[model samples]
Target chain A: MPVQLFGPVQVSDTVEIPERSGTAFTLEQGDTLIVIDPRGEQVADLLAFNAEDVAEIISSGRTFDYAETIYLTTGHELYSNRSRPMLGIIEDTVGRHDFLLTPCSYDTFHHFYPKLQPHRGCFGNLAAALEPYGIAPDMVPTAFNCFMNVPVDGATGKLRVLPPISKAGDHIAFRAHMDLIIGLTACSAPDSNGGTFKPIHYRIERG
Target chain B: MPVQLFGPVQVSDTVEIPERSGTAFTLEQGDTLIVIDPRGEQVADLLAFNAEDVAEIISSGRTFDYAETIYLTTGHELYSNRSRPMLGIIEDTVGRHDFLLTPCSYDTFHHFYPKLQPHRGCFGNLAAALEPYGIAPDMVPTAFNCFMNVPVDGATGKLRVLPPISKAGDHIAFRAHMDLIIGLTACSAPDSNGGTFKPIHYRIERG
Candidate 1:
């Protein structure tokens, strides 16, 4: 059963991603992808791959090196492994996001939540959603975690996952610089999503 | 021709990795691998994989999430994709190392050093060395950068690659928690090595 705690699903341009699940879709160059955290505190793990070549996937290292900042928001361009801009953030209602960690997986569950029932996490969801496009599990890289709060300790370089500050209906919008295959998930990790799961929403607007 | 600026190749247990190159070798469980910086300001990229199942590779995210700190040093354990401990740092001469950035590559050269002749960086070197072990390029993840100095800004979370503080003969030692295949490199990126490149040395000791 889909848990839709926010509101009645609007039938317009929005597409709802049920709690703890993921989906994949295509976005042509110049299109804008607006991802919404409909119920606040939910995290969306996002990934992008070149439509023409899967090898040219979004790269956190390249983006961080070039952008010079890990706190990516409006105006920040996401770079690919080939160092080409793939997506540019055009709008962000919630300014904080995380790119330092990889998508959580079954392994993550076993390691972090041994007492809870293990679930194949965002990694598994992305792999399954991307497999049809010729992407294998090993090919997946670190994701742009929307609405995820990971704070780094200045003195020790330590990191902590905290609840997101976004409110209901807060969304981030990205413009595709090139044709891309996007994998998006409503993150399954309890800590990442503030110990509760909720649906995510997104819409594509032609440029 | 290999540049030997450090000293006469001590033919004891040390294996010399010529400048800008990499090598892959096997280590049994409980074995210790000591990586040495024979020259000052040189960076070495190190990766590990479970010999029994190559799919279970070293995971920076898992390690960081579990260890809680990015400044990994002596007594820190490197975790695998499966959430199991793969390597434990038993000794560290230099306290600072980078696990935040991915291995630099040809794509890196094209992006950052477009003015100079583009050389495939550590990523390519690791790919070539690990290919024999059935590890593909995409299979590679962020490496434990030995002696590579990357400082993240506390205020903005920006990252900068700086010259290593490690002087000659500085080394870090890791004990294998499982039988493993290791890919190690003397990094080729100019900025990573402080505008120059040098050989890296390592030795294996049975537990």
Candidate 2:
């Protein structure tokens, strides 16, 4: 479960995401989503959703149009909500950035990290981000995970969290289509797979 | 219940706090004890652990020096667990921003908001911002409300939430002395009186 990089992105861009974007690689306008894998040794858990097309985000081997060559830079728009762009790409370090595949919150953390009881995560962030925009928690959609190494049996496509290749501070940015809102939770579960936590940093900027 | 705007602050620009700072504002270095009244019209719903020392942040406010002021154009490091700073002002939007508030949760909204259903808000995004920093729910410290316009009883000097003046997109930002972890729930508190919430942008930058 891995994905290659190719894009038009910049640093300090805004990002917006649909409530139901599956854990996959996707984009929108006026939104900045950064997967800062400290030292480029982690994976970013990403997701995407479109109005007509459910969630079409590519989890591993994300297509960045190698032919396009230009990474998402200031003003690149991500689309959603029925093909409307959700966020814009305003910054990037080119292919050097890795979309590590990481998602937070599972029952395992409850079993292992009991001291850290009631650990909440991103699934809830979406609800909070959407409130101002009129999006309610009932509208929260399933997400497409990006940078995640969800290995399917090759015969069966299944989601799985693998070791990351993203480093610290390596992030992504984008904008919103119709004021997309999202939530954030710094991974407290050391390893989400059964319950482990790896320190990560999520930063944002308005380019 | 309100303060006027002053001049642009730079790295080490000292400011003085009148008695208003004594009852309204606060500052800390070792722990994450902060709040904000985004409405800018309500008094900050602040509850302090070291409540007895309300006058200290005021004294510190007297000659509150702006040690550094970099336009968070891009890649501006505000504050983090690494190389912590004691006091940092939010040099956002010409150095005028709100960094003292909490996202009231749905429960709070229901309890405070009259007849209104729970709504979406900033709390989720605030939580998301903490994940990468390795701070978790357990790390969240008791927060103090800030920037709100609270009414002091004529003789008792008690604080109460009043109507707000904050416009859409008006925000508050701050730099933490310690690695701070925050949770958000866009305060739709029926009882929490403040201005209406319009969409706004939240950012973190490094100098």
Candidate 3:
């Protein structure tokens, strides 16, 4: 597919390689890219490399690495053990994004909180987005949360699901590994953690 | 009225007063109450006085002392002054809340954000909620955004509309001043802001 712009951006902003939420697609050489979480409360998982260099991101190319961290935030540098800044968080409005915590999914919910029944209710965000890709529900790992909140308890020193830090129009932009493939899943769990789910607009463009 | 508990607290939590969202009522003396923004992405305005200690809360019943300041982040303390913790930013999912944006109503569409007319819309959130109680459309003021994002420009130091900082179920709770009376409204607008409006639930209880 033509490298397209996905999320919303300013009127004059250039178009960049675009990808849907929770769906990963590779970028081409010489491709400029951006991902705007138009709604400040949204989050995104991004990775990049030279495409020719395996040392850049990874060979397996999983969408998310882990949740010990989540959304890209200022000070968090995207790099390899090589200690090079692949992409440093450029902008953040909601403070430190939830980099740790899995994206919300139905199968996971059935196993974790709100343990729902078989095939009923609103399909969790990631699961629904992955349906077209045929990604098995069983393969769902702990994807890092982008805008999702996961707080650390002072007394327990354990992580807990906190509220999202971004809102309807906040965004994070960065350079890319050989054209990076982007995947996202707009959350549908409208009533999960305290029923604060509010849908936001998405836009990806070239800066 | 008796006090009630709103959250999914311990199962044993009891209440003489029933707590529910989208209702209207007045506060009485000696009533310590909690007001929760179930959907963290809202700004609620509080107008209150000394239900009991008016002389103290209102600067010794000064000529004027309307509740002011923004609210957000769970565990934040809301004080009458810079000291006393009158209301704890208890149970906040989003970090900060706005205190100046007002709720939209059915009539609000016709008045503001009028480009997309011809479609169904409400005037204002609080106005609709207070219609049964004689609160009119013109009386609304800026609300405190619990999870909505409003950023002060780093360069100009001007307040600009940012994306939402909240998701579906994140919430923030505050204490009532007197027998508090409030009007509430949720989202319906699709063209305004980043358009992440979702349904939300509210709760009230006695502390």
What's the true lDDT of residue A196 in model 2? 40
Most accurate candidate by lDDT? 1
DockQ of 2: 0.01
2 or 3, greater by TM-score: 3
Worst 10 residues of 2 chain A by lDDT: A59-68
Off by over 4 Å in 1: A1-12, B1-12
Cα deviation of B157 in candidate 1 (Å)?
A: 0.7
User: Could you tell me the lDDT of residue A51 within candidate 1?
Assistant: 93
* Residue-level lDDT tens digits of model 2 in A126-168: 4454455444433333232323332322112112344433444
Which candidate number maximizes DockQ?
1
Order of candidate numbers by lDDT, starting with the best: 1, 3, 2
Ranking by TM-score: 1, 3, 2
DockQ of each: 0.44, 0.01, 0.01
Q: Model 3, which residues run further than 4 Å from truth?
A: A1-21, A28-72, A80-86, A113-142, A190-196, B1-207
| Alpha carbon lDDT at B129, candidate 3 | 56
Candidate 1 lDDT over A97-125, as tens digits, reads: 99878888988788789998999899999
What's the lDDT for candidate 2?
0.32
